[model samples]
Target: MRLVVFDVDGTLVDSQADILASMVDAFAAVGLDAPARQDILGIVGLSLPVAMEALVADADHARMVEAYKGSYAKLRLSKGASSSPLYPGARAALDRLQAQDDILLGVATGKSKRGLDGLIEAHGLNGMFVTRQVADFHPSKPHPSMLRAALEESGVETADAVMIGDTSFDARMAHAAGMPFLGVGWGYHAPSQLDGARAILNDFSELDDALNALWTD
Candidate 1:
């Protein structure tokens, strides 16, 4: 069987607006300034601490980090939570992949279990994914633990797997596991940022072609 592991945040859903808004609110709550939208979105694939580190240069970044978490959690739990929406054609692509008997679908993301669970369940996408590797269960991005765990859970070999995401981090993880990496253009990472990816697509329609070309060998 062919295993297709996807990144949830950018590849499936366009949560950049909500993510940036929440970060801005979090910074405001702590009396600190938030990074610009472009800057924040640039670090989308990294874990919270890593991303924050990239934004703050001061020594008191730890404290700011805590405050940011407080604001982010609160916002996610309340009003700003449901602002994220799936990218156009994401559902159709997933549905098409699900109908194939030889293909398996799963998720590998930096989002915490609670957050990912809420989003997946809310969109009724739980059944479409067989395995999930989230931040709560694994180390941050660039680590192979999450990908390894997801593959283990899905009973798939590294050779049979591919990672579909929008960030270089996702491509890096796939590289660590000797898996093919496909980058998306309509997501958080700019196309130029995904230089190491095996293939890059501007829209969902190109996905099947890329996958077929990769696996046909």
Candidate 2:
């Protein structure tokens, strides 16, 4: 079977507003200013502690992580899926892929297990993924642990699996795992940053076409 692994935050959904807001709150809680928007976005695929360090080398990462989690939880409860809505055409593309018998869906994300579960529940995406890998159990992105776990869980070969995401982190992780990659242009990273991607799509509407091209070639 062919495996399709997706990244959460900036890939399937657009969570920039909520992520930035929570990050701002987290930095404030730690008595510091948050980095610029682009700088924050650059760290989207990293674990919370790593992201915190990247944003502030000497800041208290633990406090910021908790503060961000607390703030995000509150935001999720108050705003629900509105805080991180799926991209346009995302549902359609997902439904179409799920209908296919030869493909298995999976997720490799930097989100905590609770956060990923919340997003799944909020978006009614329960049972959509055959495997879900999160930061709670694995190293941050650009490491192969999560992708390797997804492959092991799905029982798919590297040659038949493609990691779809918006960040350089995803591309590097896929490479490290010996898997192919497809980049999303609308994600936090620029296409220029997506080095070694087989193809990049401007939107979800081209997802299947891109996947097909990647696999058939």
Candidate 3:
């Protein structure tokens, strides 16, 4: 069986604007300045704590985490999760993949299970994926554990699976898991940053071709 694992935030959806806005709101709630979008984007795919470590040099970790959660909750509770939306052709691409009897769909993302599930439910993608490995279950990106779990959960070997994402972290993680990486160009991370990827897909239209080629190999 061929299992295709995907990253959520940047690979299938564009949530940067909402995410950045929420980060700014979090910083304001804590009386701190928000980091630049470049900095935040650079740390895409990392776990929350890891992202914080990359962006904040002097802030107390625990305090900042609490503040961020508090502020994000305040905004998220009232905001109705308007940030994450499927990218153009994303649904079509996924449906095409699913139409193949040999292909199995799964998610390996840095998002929390609640967040991931919420997005999937909101977008009516409940049954699109057979398995999910969220941040709540494993260490952040650049670590092989998450991918490993996804492979295990989907009952597929790393060699038979492909990882699709939008950051260097995802490429490196796929490499670590001994799987092929397909980098998405329209994400927060630059395509150049994923130079080590098995292939870089410029958009959803290219995604089907990339997957077809990868599976054909």
Taken over the whole model, the C-alpha lDDT of each candidate is 0.81, 0.93, 0.82
| Top-scoring candidate (lDDT) | 2
Ranking the candidates on TM-score from highest down gives 2, 3, 1
Candidate 1 lDDT, 33-86, residue by residue in tens: 887888888778777777777787653556655665565566656644365677
Clashes of each: 0, 0, 0
Q: How far is candidate 1 from the true structure (C-alpha RMSD, Å)?
A: 2.1
> What is the C-alpha lDDT profile of model 3 across 1-217, one tens digit per residue?
9999999888898878767876776566557898988987788788877887888776666666666556555544565546577898999999998999988999888877777877787777878998888887788898999888878788888778999999989999998988999998889888999857878887788877787788788
Q: Spell out the clash pairs found in candidate 2.
A: none
User: Which segments of model 3 are wrong by more than 4 Å?
Assistant: 70-81
Give, for candidate 3, the lowest lDDT window spanning 10 residues: 72-81
- Judge candidate 2 at residue 175 and give its lDDT: 93
Best candidate, TM-score-wise?
2
Query: Candidates' TM-scores?
Result: 0.91, 0.99, 0.92
TM-score of decoy 1 = 0.91
Residue 177 accuracy (lDDT) in model 1: 79
